[model samples]
Target: MLVIQIYADNPLRNFNYLIACPSSREALVVDPLDVTRCLAAAKQHGLKITKILNTHEHWDHIDGNEEMRRHTGARLYAHNGAMGVIDHVDVGLYAGDTIAVGQSIKLKVLDTPGHTRSHVCLLANSAVPGLFCGDTLFNAGAGNCHNGGNVDDLYDTFSQQLAKLPDNTKIYPGHDYILTNLKFTLDREPGNRAAEDMLNMLLDHDPHNAYITTMAEERRINSFFRLDSPVIIDKLKSEDPDFSAAPSPRDVFTALRARRNTW
Candidate 1:
């Protein structure tokens, strides 16, 4: 299995993915916001994109769907719940559905609804695990529930689902917000040496070169994964001293999400 992550030169800083089988060279594309870039990348890799998949119905994630499908004659795959919002979906994907790319790669869909009620993340159990999390999760921060999403559901998805991934699983989110998200980590947990070190590293050279991250590393850097940290709780307490006598992890997660909204 071969996975190529392409950074889209768009205002949203979207990242499109192309996962293919080395032997067959047939690929599956995820959230193609830039059709031309996706096509060019596929061409460079000698890959034929056989399927275009969207994590949800967000415009930026699906903007290139029609054009990509027309260009490659690729079938579109998306969550059935998002069918109402996204057009021309050839396959209605569901939780546990496995979509095969070429002969080796089989992406198993996981129902993750936080960024949107219909959002889904894909898992590729290759030599190294990869999760195409889209807007459901990010490098240092979890996605917001502003657009047709629920924070409680987001909490459940994080605690019940994403947290179970192996420490080595590499998260391939839809957008590049790690630098800013890491800053948010320091804002809440100012004493976090790991986040500080990562923030400084990202400040050097081209930050995109420091993009790849693993779950174990995220445990040290991502604030969302560190809801139990006393420093973060103290920061939140500084704002509302009586918020909770002893805040639960869920409470801390909720408060952090709220603060990030204004950050």
Candidate 2:
């Protein structure tokens, strides 16, 4: 069985995860935001953390990398581009790298660079794929373009890379703001029945930890994932009349992030 844990932290309200394979008693910590909490969880679960996998070098995502590595003596892994930011990385993973987690779990790395040039999302459960999409994708949301982020890059990463994942793949994002993100989606496309329905569900239920969404759900409700929808396209055209005839999904997503940044 695959065991996953999500932890929310300060500043960005980020959600970090730990995925373990029960068969081997080995684990991999993904974008751990808090060192103490991550270590505590490992101990509580009797997990031997053998790897510290980084999605990117953002302060929040990697702040605990150094500490966690020291605690577990696990090998530090990061995309090759993160050499400068990550002090002592042992594994330099790239787009096609496949990492073993315990005896049963294998993560196929997809070099998804939009939030940061080095950002990578781990595609796990290849036999039954799921994504531990750090900041690359989220539940009705995606990462911001603050660090090395670019609108064009975000577009390619989401549309060409992540959006193509099988609809059933469970999306364990870097955070839980589906409700807030859905609200923004509604604002952008008021007549969207799908977004409205999702909004209602989120309203009715508290969207507790159990509410993490699937790829199919995000495809319908996430504005970024619905760039082809007339509602979103119209809004994009209104904002920048000279924009390309077919603006990428990242274009719409970047605009949304900018709007939210000022909110």
Candidate 3:
């Protein structure tokens, strides 16, 4: 069996996940911001840290890499494209690379760029189907463009790569921004009953508990999934001057993300 544990950290409230394969007693840490917490958690769980899987090269996601790798002798796995940023990635993953964690446990790397040119998402069905989405995806929404983000690229990644995953897949994003992102989703899709109800529920409680969102839920409510929907495209055009003309899905997504980044 495979188990996942989450640790939230620092100013960004980044969410780090530790995945373990019980039979082999081996584990992988994903996007840890602090090595102290990751090491502590590993000790508590009685699992040997074997690998460090990076979803992207963002400082927050990779800051603990050097420390954790040195302390635990864990191999660092990252996109082959992030050569300079992430030093010594033992397993350089690509769009279709498959990584074996233990017996009956494997992660399928999907090169879901647009959040960054080298960004990728780790998909697996070890226990529950899961997606360790770094900056590429978030709770109720997706990542904002920071370094190499292109709206068009994000659209293709979301619609083609991520959308292809099974609806039951559990989406564990790099950060916990559900409440805030849910508000944005509500604004973008006011008529969505699920979005409205979820927003109401979030407004009444703390956002920390709303960290995890399912792929099934995202498909029903996330604006990015509604690529051909006139309401979504119209909203994107209204907010993004760059998308005033005939724009592709990527152009529209970029504009929306640009506006959100400034918010």
List where candidate 1 sits over 4 angstroms from the true fold: 205-210
Q: Who is ahead in lDDT, 2 or 3?
A: 2
Clashes of 3: 3
Leading candidate by TM-score: 1
- Model 1 Cα RMSD, 1 decimal: 1.1
Assess each prediction's global lDDT (C-alpha) against the native.
0.90, 0.80, 0.78
**TM-score, each model?**
0.97, 0.90, 0.89
Cα deviation at 110, candidate 3, in Å, is 0.9
Off by over 4 Å in 3: 204-211, 234-248
Predicted structure with the largest lDDT when compared to the true one: 1
The better candidate by lDDT, 1 or 2, is 1
Per-residue alpha-carbon lDDT of candidate 2 for residues 78-166, written as tens digits (9 for 90 to 100) = 99999787888898988889999899888889998888999888988665578988888878877788778776787788878887889
lDDT of 3: 0.78
- Give per-residue CA lDDT, model 3, range 168-252, as digits (tens): 8888888777778877776776687877887776676553454456788887767666556677777777766666567676666
